[model samples]
Target: MFSKILIANRGEIACRVIRTARKLGVRTVAVYSDADAHALHVEMADEAVHIGPSPVGESYLRGDKIIAAALATGAEAIHPGYGFLSENPDFVDQVVAAGLTFIGPSATSIRAMGLKDAAKRLMEKAGVPVVPGYHGEAQEIVLLASKAREIGYPVLIKARAGGGGKGMRKVEHPDDFSEALSGARREAKAAFGDDRVLVEKYVDKPRHIEVQVFGDNFGNAVHLYERDCSAQRRHQKVIEEAPAPGMTPELRKAMTDAAVKAAKAISYSGAGTIEFIVDASQGLKPDRFWFMEMNTRLQVEHPVTEMVTGTDLVEWQLRVASGEKLPKTQAEITLSGHAFEARIYAEDAAKGFLPATGTLYHLKFPDTVPEGATMRVETGVRAGDAISPYYDPMIAKLVVHAKDRPLALQALVAALRQTEVAGSTVNAAFLAALAADPDFSKGDVDTGLIGRHQQALTEIAPPNADIVAAAALAASGAGALPPSNDPWSSLAGYQHFHPAARRTRLHYGEHDITAKVSVRPDGRFAVTLDEPYGSTNAHDLRAAPRLARWPGHVTVFSGAVGYTFAVPDPLARADESAASSGSLRAPMPGLVKLVRVTPGETVTKGQPLLILEAMKMEHTIAAPHDGVIAEIATEGAQVTDGTVLVRFAEDVHA
Candidate 1:
């Protein structure tokens, strides 16, 4: 095996590669940008080199800098762990030219599958099933729309150049094809510098099932079964599993064989994934599956695959890159159990799943998560680490495995509930909802699972009455309401005139809850409420009511959550309008990359007029619609909380 290798990536993927390299006794080098100087991956690697500034354009995307760092560190091979420069053929060629091995597919192979149109054509020739659509080099708007009409409505326009759901659009009608095509092309150019797109048949009920394929230099390749990545949001994968939900033995064999064929046809070596979109409306048949694309490096959800196969794919990548054959034969690799992986991202699930960034005050997974039972956590960031907006917002990946699909899902749900992350909004509750969903539990998996019940899935976890009462008691900082005469003392629960009941309001999003506390004789107050989720009563008026506190501290509540109200000399007050709406805000900290309109431009409802790039993905902020843009508040600025993007016209004025 090669003595050393360089991981041409950062964050979790870099750490993932280093782990396997360490297990194989191979030294690993990590390259990082300025923003990730103290990142977890940098601290874990044997060696780390600072490549450039924080922005990807200046650092991670700079092939020359990465190559130089690899050579300086004396790495014998380079592993492009997805993203950045992974699929860029020039980087692979340059690494090979520098007398170092590229631990992935050959540059020629990548070039063949780099473009969507070209890859589809190649797959068709390789005897792999392909989606029926236009792959011709026609860029005219009229022609493309006509072609969409010819192919029937609901054709997909996808950027021929990039993945990650960027530069992809689904047109549902002949009328909207032209506008959607232009937008897809624009995004494609911005993301991959390739405006070319491939139009394909949009499967109504598509299940994304991809096979894990491994190969050696001797043209020998084997498939490691398949992963069902049907649960998705905004074209990005959120949850994935191995063996699929409704897989037959015959269908599994056929899919695996086709994946192996695609890999061998290109003389593919090392680790790669051949993704297929299956038309489940007709039930999974050998003919119903179509080639989607090939990921040329290790996938993010690879741990679940590892759990089922009892093999380490990264170790295989190193072994194959070092001129050794794959450790397992086609028959030797077998799926033993079902596995699942939920991608835990630092994002607001309720608010369109926009990537969020914050200091992780505490981040911990469940210790009860089974070891041999298949629950695993693969993450790089730890407690106290600040989640930066310069890259992906994924904080960790929670993987679970079981003897059967039902058991695996049960394990997954328990793990998600036990997993707790403080100081930022996460998708934990949403993932839990998915794990416990009856439809999901049953084999009704598809890419549309998220969209089908988006509201219910992303719904915020309402504060339980017990928890709310606990927060109130913690906020008061006393076991009971201190007597007004001796308010500074800790023991007073009730005083003169029926215990001086006070009213405090809580505001969560657009909803409001009012709690009226009547200090009781037993140091516990009865709290009655008119809450958005309905009224309830909560108790426990002790100094520290319930043990929900973290670290060495307990939180007295504040605002809607309860701010600890210490029994000091005096207190403050609030008004009726304090619960009303403030200005429309940015919601999170990020860079305002583009402003699509000026202050006076009139726009229709849902018209996107601003773009923000945060958490490694671009987000377009739109006008709510049918109004004039007044007080447009952003333009390529680094904004923080409450940075208004645009205001409504005069009618919206309060």
Candidate 2:
């Protein structure tokens, strides 16, 4: 193996590669942009180099800068972790030209599988079953629409150049085909710089099962097994598991054989994944599965595969790149147990899964595990790290393993419940709900599971009296006081007549609440909450809810849910009336991609007015109610969070 290698990526994947390299006594170099100067990956690497500015185009996407950094650091090879330059064929050629080993497949192999349409055609020639679709080169709108009609209604338009649910759309009818195609093309161009798309038949009940395959330069390849990524939202994988549920021996053999065939067809070397879209309306059968696309690098969910198979894929990549033969034959690699991986992202599931950006005031994960189970957290962030708009908002990946699927899933749910985060919104509760979902527990999952039950899954119960009292105690600084030995200090609130009480004001959601707190002689707290409904609830507690206090906010974690309350300043003026104003503000910092409605144009509630691109995704700003647009932000405008994008005109009477 090479003595040193350069990781040409950022975030958890980069950090993950570094850990494996360290295990083999290989020195690792990390490259970072301005946004990630003090990132955890940088701190963990043996050496670090600054590439460019924070934007991807200026830094992570700059192949020349990355190559230069690798050469300067004397790195013998470059490891492109997952995203950014990982799948770019040109970058692979550049790395080879620089006389540095690229720890992945060759440029020819990537090119063969880069474009979805071309890859599908190649698979068909190789005798691998592919989805029936329009894989032709024609780009005209009329021709594409005709092809969609030929394929039948409810077709999917997917970008030929990329994956991860970007630049993809599903059209239910001919009437919506044009609009969907336009949106897909625009997003594709923005994401992959290629607007070319292919029309495919949409499977009603689809399960995304991808086989993990590895190949060596000696023309030897083997399958590690499969992962089921059916639990998804917005066409992105949310939870993934290895040794797919209900996978029969015959079905597994067929899928793995086909996957190995696809890999060897291109003389593929290193790690790659062959993703198949399974038509599960029936059941798992050999003929019901079709090739969707190929990912030419290590996958984000590779940990689940590693946990179950007891192998390190990164070490395999290193050994293969060093001109080693296959470490073990197909039979030597054995599957032992089940594993599940849940991706924790800095997003708000309550508000349509909007990406959130903020400093992490407090961050934590489960430190204890149940017997016969193992828990691992793969993350590149620390407690004080900031989640900015310049990169993906993924927080971490929580992986759990056990002897069986039921115990593994039980451990996963418990781990999620113990995880805590503050300063920004997260989807912990949503993930916990998804893991504990009845259908999910029963293994009845498909790509449409999250979409079908989104409303119920995103529902979070309001804080009960106990949670409110905890927050009130934290906000009042009463929870931080130490136990007193003196009777005078403990009896300070004792009065000659009635007990002394202090009121604290806090804001929860949209309502302002007043908490009346009184200190008892027994060192307990008596809290009375005044509700907006003209009701009062009282609670006496010896212990406060588990909470973390920041400057102006306190977060109380109850099970998988976290309730954050704002400590209001008593001297500040009240401005709650503006909550009803008909103004649409940007939820996060992003660039305005398109403006669909002009000033003075009438729009109904939920009508798309503009689109904001942020965190590598597009968010559509819609009208809050039926009204006439009075003021609006223009296209190509860079906006920050809370920036008003559109305002409605006041109603006038003649």
Candidate 3:
């Protein structure tokens, strides 16, 4: 095995690689941008090197800088962990030219599967079943529209060059094809620098099942079963599981065999995934599955595979890159138990899953579970780390395993309930709702599951009296006071004849609540909350509430949902101008990619006015109502959160 290797990535994947390298007694080097200088991965590596500024164009994407850092640190090889340069064929060639081992598939193999249209053609020639669509080289709009009509309605336009749900769109009819194509091409060009796309027949009821395959220098390969990533939104996998539910032995054999065949067809080396889009309108069958695409590196969902198969894929990558043969034949790798992985992202599910950026003042995960189950949290951020707009807003990947699928799912739900976070909006509650969903628990899932039930899933219930009382106590510091011998020290609520009530003001969501507290001799609090409906609710607590109080905020976790309250400053003035202004502000810090309207242009409600690109996704700023644009931010401008992007004419009526 190589003595030392450099991880050419950041975030949890980098930290994940470093852990495995350390286990195998291989020292690891980490490369970081200015944004990740104090990141968890950097602190875990044996040596660290600063590459460039925070922007990816200047740092993580600079192949020369990464290569130089690896060479300077004397790393024998480089591991591109799943993103950035992982699937870039040119970067692979550059690494080889630098005389350093690239710990992944050969450049030829990557090129064979880099472009979707070309990859589909290659698969067809290799006798691998492919989805019926237009894989031709023609890029004319009229021709593409004709092909969509030929393939039938509801076709999917996918970028040939990238993955992760970027540059992808589903058109339901010919009338919407042109607009969807424009959006897809623009996003594709911005994401992959390739606007070319391919039209494919959209499976009505699809289940994304991908097989994990590995190959070695000696021309041997094996498949590690499969993962069902059907729980998704906008074609992005939300929760993934191994040993797909209702998968028969015959179906498994057929899928795994085809996966191994695809890997060996290109003389593939190291770790790769063959993703298949399964048509589950019927059920799991050998003929109903077709090749979607192949990920040419280690996957983000590899941990679930590891839990079921009892193998370390990273260790396999290192050994194979060192010219070793396949670790085990197909029979030696046996599936044991069931596993599930839930991706926790720093996003607000209620607000259309918008990405959130802030400091994580409180972050906690379940460290202990039941005896028969195991819980693992793969994260790169700590309690005090900041989630910036420069990178993916993924907080962590929470994985759980048990003896059976039902128990494993139970453990997953429990783990999510036990997890807590603060200082930013998160999707933990949404994940919990999905995991505990009736159809999901019964394994009746498809790519459209989340979409079909999004409104119900994203709806957050109002906090009960206990929760509000907890926040009020935290805000007032009434439950956290030190014991005093003198009764006068706690006389705030005391009266000559009877106990008096002291009121504390606190802010929750959008309303300011006044909480009345009366202390008891037993150290309990009689709390009364003034409800919004001109009524009062009271609760007498038995003990101190479970919560975390920061300088200006307090977070209370109730099951899987966390409620954060702002402890307003007593002497600070209130500013509500932004809330009442007729302006559209950027929701997150990002680059202004396009200004769709000029000043004084009229737009209708929900019309696209501008595009803000952040965290590798484009968000279109839309008109809130019929109005005339008075002013607009310039295109190609870097903007922070809440920066005004478009202002409406005050004289114009909606």
Give the range where candidate 3 is weakest over 10 consecutive residues by summed lDDT.
533-542
lDDT of 1 by residue, 39-84 (tens): 8899989999999998788999999998999999999989999888
For candidate 3, write residues 1-654 as lDDT tens digits.
999999999999999999999999999999999999999999999999999999888999999999999999999999999889999999999999999999999999999999999998998888889999999999999999999999998999999998988899999999999989988898899888999999999999999999999999998999999999999876778899998998988878888888999999999999999999999998888889999999999999999999999999999999999999988898899999999999999998987788999998889999876668998899999999999899989999999999999999999999998888888889999999999999999999999999999999988888777788878766876656544444344435568755566677888888888887666555455667787523232234444455778778888888898888888888887775445367888888988988899998989999999988887777889999998888899999999988978888973233
Off-target runs (Cα >4 Å) in candidate 1 are 370-372, 476-507, 511-583, 589-597, 602-608, 611-620, 625-627, 633-641, 649-654
Which residue pairs in candidate 2 collide? none
Q: Where does candidate 3 stray beyond 4 Å?
A: 482-502, 532-544, 576-579, 651-654
Per-model CA lDDT versus the true structure: 0.78, 0.90, 0.89
Error of 3 at 82 (Å): 0.9
- Residue 151 alpha-carbon offset, candidate 2, angstroms: 0.7
Error of 2 at 133 (Å): 0.9
* Residue 134, model 3: Cα distance from true site in angstroms: 0.9
Error of 3 at 49 (Å): 0.2
